[model samples]
Target: MAHTKASNTPSPRTIIPTPVNSTADFAAQQRNMSADNASQGSGVKLKKEIGLLDGVAIIVGVIVGAGIFVSPKGVLLYSGSIGQSLIVWILCGILSMVGALCYAELGTMIPKSGGDYAYINVAFGPLPAFLYLWVALLVIIPTGNAITALTFAQYLLQPFWPSCDAPVEAVQLLAAALTSLLTVINCYNVRWVTRVTDVFTGTKIFALLVIVAVGIWYLCAGHTDHWNEPMRGTFTAPGLIALAFYNGLFSYAGWNYLNFVTEELKDPYRNLPRAICISMPVVTLIYVITNVAYFTVLTPEEILSSDAVAVTFGDKMLGFMSWLMPFFVACSTFGSLNGSIFASSRLFFVGARNGHLPAAISLINVHCLTPVPSLIFLCVITLILLFIKDVYTLINYVSYVEALFTTLSVSGLLWLRHTQPKTERPIRVSLALPIIFLITCLFLVISSVFQSPIEVGIGTAIIISGIPVYYLTIHRPVEWLRNLSQSFNLWCSKFFICMPNQEKFD
Candidate 1:
């Protein structure tokens, strides 16, 4: 006979004496234990190996992607002068800073990953949060990554191609490969991802500084004709300025990507806000100086006429060194793609953990300690999007929805404050911050509605498409579907060698 402990913990029997009958029996027992853990609602969790500099890298890398190089023309097109262009850049920076402050407070209070998804889930409810996730899954995050990768491919391949327009097949194939590369990188340990981001972030910053330095040299040597005519073709129409600001906002889009990985950041309460505070202002200054540099080297007419502003600026200013611009743009866009995969995968992981998505996506590789399933899922979705032509048109259809959800997210700050007054806040801003950001977001959405009603309608319809999904999953989930989801999740865990652990949410 064998004896067993008499404690409260459950046991297989009153008297436990049997050993494993075979290795197969041991493997079966392990699988059963994992399945039980999964049924108990436990999941894999993220490790916090990131720091302040890592956070800043994510923000700067994602925010500075290819946009600053190309968008000068768009800004100058609408602003009609260097002064107005600079103003738009600075104002968008301030708006981003205020928005970051609000997010910092929320990130600390909740102290979770998922960024806006976590904040909105707590402040509003699951329905609205699910809707946000639906759009993110189908549109916002994937399209954003696809656009960045396509841009990267376009710039990287432009040198070899004879025409100004890159060959469409080459661009698409290379973009897909780029996405696959970054996805594989992120599926490993977190440090690998941040390390890549930091190095590329440094590279892009150095490239920008080179441009700024050359511009300063030109200005010092008296290339000042454009400086004298700062407001010549100014279009101060409400619609035009709104549109200009809208474009500027797109360039400033990735400031909040850092917040998405809050769980992975060391000392997040202090570092999250500090990273945002540092990166936003620095990027703002870079944008202003870089635009000034562009205008210093290229006249407004040349700037407008050129298809690629930074390339033109390089050709005009850098002389023999003009060959470096395309490489720099490619690096910048590659970093953005890597950082986007890093951040957006976390959103999917968190959403999956919370039952908003299939639990398989929440799996973390035991050896790698990364969200393998989520990363792979995002890779497939983004790769599918890579096949779609006209990335800008696809992005435009969802821009309104992106702005609307961001407004809803920032508004969560106010809603949470009123509802959860006692929640601890490590970096609270004045009420005016979120209030002001929400107003700006609302103006953008409303103005877009008036300006592009049809596109806005399409975006709204895409979001509304999630309702039936919501009803099927949350409101009226089927037993067979749940069983199938659980079985699939178990299979993935076993295949990936995942070790199930209890996930914590604040």
Candidate 2:
């Protein structure tokens, strides 16, 4: 009897599902299963596979783009003092790190894919979440991508045309083409996309590091003429210092890109938090050192007056390598474009999935397991932005709204801390940290409001436009108020009413 145990096992193919429920339900089930199957087929067994290195690469790649190349001049113009400008950079780095820490906690707790959208939705409800998504999709991501792409194209073209005179239309077209090509490459394979990002990010970091080292050596070799200049009167003013700090903060953007891919990051609860913490300090160090080098080799007056500080620095360091600086700048901007495209498409995909955007955009390719529709949508929008005449103006307008939403997102951290105190937290920062972050973000938002009223008006119009579209596409006119009330009530309860029980006291 013991020897009679059966050796036969049913083949996986032989096990077919016995259907139950209406055709619609069955179809829905099949669609989900197919999506799951596609994910499996791509050998993407863990969305959480991204490690510390990938996280660092994303943070650095996003932060070190055209901002550093173009921003130093602005910072110098605003600060008018090398020492004061360096201090502004340091303060900005610290503020960014604080905000990043707050975000790290939220990201780990949610462990979802959408980054700020998910956090805002959970804490503030659908309307705010939708607005955040709308602003990001329509203004921030597209304009940001265009700026980076345009910067890349400009730098690449600079070497060929040493005169630095080129047709604006030609640069715009080239930028658009570059963005579209990168979007296609990313849509094809996630692994290859990551590899390309790694290469570009590495190249930019190496170039910057070399520039820093050369500047140090040159300073040691009697290049101190720029270091002992009298402090400029403009830099002595507090208002100018504030402006430089804001500019420095803008250059340090992308501290939060890693949070967008939480679902794909392995051990997000641990790795995501650690990645942000580690990357912030590393980037801050790089930025500080780079500024010191610039100040050592070139005066504030020189930097404020120069269009290409990095190129000037390179020429000073090694005459021959001056030709190579533009290539490095191109690589830096390209990496930033790639990172922005990668992170931002996920926001669209999540919005579409949640019925906040057009459902068609939620489509996932069965073979590649990528959100092809969202990717294409992003590409088209970026192309449109490329036609806009001024990248700086676009960035300013988009950043104002982005800073507003970011302020909202940071407020969500405080709201969640009070409301969901009993909920398990994967990462925890000190209470003071969030308070500092909220204050910093609120300051930035207020500053933005005062700095560019017209741009803020345009950004508000873009957000309000979404409400009508939402009603037409998803909600009935009669029930619109009812749904809105329900959403408001939910936000209040989750963010205000639902305090933690006694055992979990903060």
Candidate 3:
């Protein structure tokens, strides 16, 4: 036994094998491994299935809302010419199309959800991404829904109770109730929400078509004299073009909403690009034709002075049926709110899933497969904002921020082009398109800032305040301070925070 314990380790040895058999077995094993990896990758790539029609429906549902219903009066007031205002709409549509195209490339490249937040993060990193998400949750989405809800309640109540002396509180409560109800519907089932939205979107489009058809018919009958009246402002002039562009920009607000649901959209690479390209031109045509109809029936002065622009146009041609205008407006607003609720909640969900937001927001309702917590949180905030008497103030404040963020998001396309050159981009922008998009966005941002310097300043303050909160929530004390310092410097250099060289917290 002692002698046998001499070697605990064994000597190396080689054994011969059938070379052909071993080679065949090795090749078979490799093929099996490759097949397994492919299957696993496909599983990871799976996403919610939505088609091009759904994408188009979502875009139209969100875009054709209170803007068209309420903004015509404001644009008429600004431009003082129906024809010139229509031109503005056209210009905005074109600019929006350019932006949408840029986003399409980004959306296809990333093919993730979360809309602007995703694009911004991929290009600039997390801080700027979180800032946009913070602003969107606190300001843009809530305020927008509140404004629409209030408008919806106002018009719906106005027609039914024209002579009823209701308290302001009653109207506010009604608006909040309507907003809450729609929120519930949307939070329950995606399919149900989409179906409701489709109906509302279709109705709104049909109503607009009817108005245009009737107005044109009346003009052909020589019932109106405003068709040949000179435009309110000179064509192609800077002032006129600027005014028109603003109007068009308002109409183009939701053109990029489809990008928000990239994960839910089936075949996003094909559907998203097609949906945006198709929807913008169609909406532009609708706006131009509708404005032409309006001008054919009423003078620029009349449109400018009218409190309810669509109703006035309807009244001139449709008489008693004009009351339907408010109802249609309500439907349009409801659809818009639903679309926003659906898209914006996904922003929070994605942010949370990626650790940018709290875990609570990312919690999915297993039963409904919807982000119920986020949806309910948004509803509460919107309900509170519904009490604000004036919609214009909210728009003035939120629109500026939205335009700024949108500009930043579009500018991200340039960064991605350099950083992720080999990344899969199912959609591609032309060489000059990004340049044109950037220029247009800059103009819009400048115009918005000049138009509402005070509101823009307030918005800036609100957005910047998020940095501290973000640190508090996500980082340890010392790390938080360091991150804040770094973020301040980064934002100063990139976003023109307070000074050109020195980064200040304020």
Candidate 4:
């Protein structure tokens, strides 16, 4: 029975009673049950229901989010010309594909949840992994959810605010509600999550196709002027181009996260790679076509001036159907929230399972077959973020950190080839894939740092701050920390109602 490893179940090879004493004891006790170990009878497992299509939906659903609708303006602002903007989008697609292929290799190799956390833990060590986890929990997941939720709220309520400037408080409230709704939805089961993802993915894709179709029809009907002066209004500075890449890359962010739930995917070794290969190209083509549709109607000035580029395009092109654009954009953002909540919860579950976080965070609802505790935690954090003023500004801080960790995670391909060459790699990528992705990631990080040193410093400091916390909880394992974890687990079990109580790892 070659199954995915469960977060709560220890490997049968090592039996241990509850309440382990020291950090070393806990670390040694928590087995890294890879695919090989599971075949030897590790009852610990997650239900594998995600098929090829579901896996592809998760990738596509998360990647094609509010960024695509909003990022084009930033790209045009720096791209210096319409042609350069399109070129940047294409280059980003290529860059994302390279990174996705590299991760496909790593995902099959590890076949575990936690995405970057799993890869970094294996290649470098636990400390670096812990730092990544720290940033992920605190920044990456919450900020992303908040940003998407806000985007969703804006679009959903855009009709009321015809001027497109909705009240900040009203938007945050709706965003909070949206985050809570998705979190609750994800608490059901993997099947439900995938079903919702499939429907939403289809809806958004259909919407994009509608846009593409109409754009082509409109172009055929005489919207040739925008294409004629493609280079009319473009900006051409190095810093600006670099910033454009950042925006474009952000739109392509979620392509790597399908690996976060690898344990839940059916025949992960084969399906994971297939899903990545299929989703990235589809998303790229859709994105390119959608941009073409936008340029078909809106000029560079129109695009740069509008807060919601998609809505503006709709207003210009669609007769009475312009009203539908906000609804479609809301659907896209909501789907993105679903995907983010689903993936981020797995990181918390994996972090707790690996003994880097509170043991309570690992609780899974056996009946529901979901990481309930982790999902709730993410929802709560996202809700908190909704209250913060200028949450979108926080994106740059996490973006810098995201690029750094992604670079490190992709480099694992090179490291593991040297260190664990004999380890079964069902899908190995070319050496150049990781190299190219790393160079691209490094360039993004360096450019962003030069442009926004303060934000980069904040991100770096947050990662470094994890070092002492890591020492306190993981390295030293203080008695107070043990008590705190135990209390937290107890509180979570009691309050969350549905979350199952697993034996504490500590």
How many pairs of residues collide in model 1? 0
Q: What is the lDDT of residue 484 in candidate 2?
A: 60
Off by over 4 Å in 3: 1-47, 164-166, 235-244, 389-392, 475-506
Put the candidates in TM-score order, highest first: 1, 4, 2, 3
Global lDDT scores for all candidate models: 0.84, 0.74, 0.72, 0.82
Candidates' TM-scores? 0.91, 0.85, 0.82, 0.89
Number of the top-ranking candidate, with TM-score as the measure:
1
lDDT of 3 at 499: 12
Q: Model 2, which residues run further than 4 Å from truth?
A: 1-46, 229-231, 234-239, 477-506
Model 1 worst lDDT window (10 residues): 9-18
Alpha-carbon deviation at 353 in model 4, angstroms? 0.5
Give the per-residue lDDT digits (tens) of candidate 2, residues 1-506.
Answer: 02223645322222223343443443454455445445544321223445677878888888889777667887778877776777778888999999889889888777776788988998999888988887888778888888889888888888667875667887898898899899998677777667777888899889889878987897889978766753655455544555676788889988888887776777788788788878888888888898888888876767877777887877766787687788888999999888888878878877766777655455454335556667888999989888877655766666667777778888898898889998788788899988887777676667656766777778788889988766665565446654563344233222221110111101
lDDT of 4: 0.82
Better of 1 and 4 by lDDT: 1
How high is the lDDT of residue 272 in model 3? 92
- lDDT of candidate 1 over 25-106, digit per residue (tens): 5346556655655575543457789898888999999999888988778887878788898899899999998888988998
List ranges where model 1 is wrong by over 4 Å: 1-44, 162-164, 499-501
Worst 10 residues of 2 by lDDT: 497-506
Top candidate when judged by lDDT against the true structure: 1
Task: Give the CA lDDT, 0 to 100, for residue 59 in model 1.
Answer: 97
Cα-based lDDT at residue 99, candidate 1 = 88
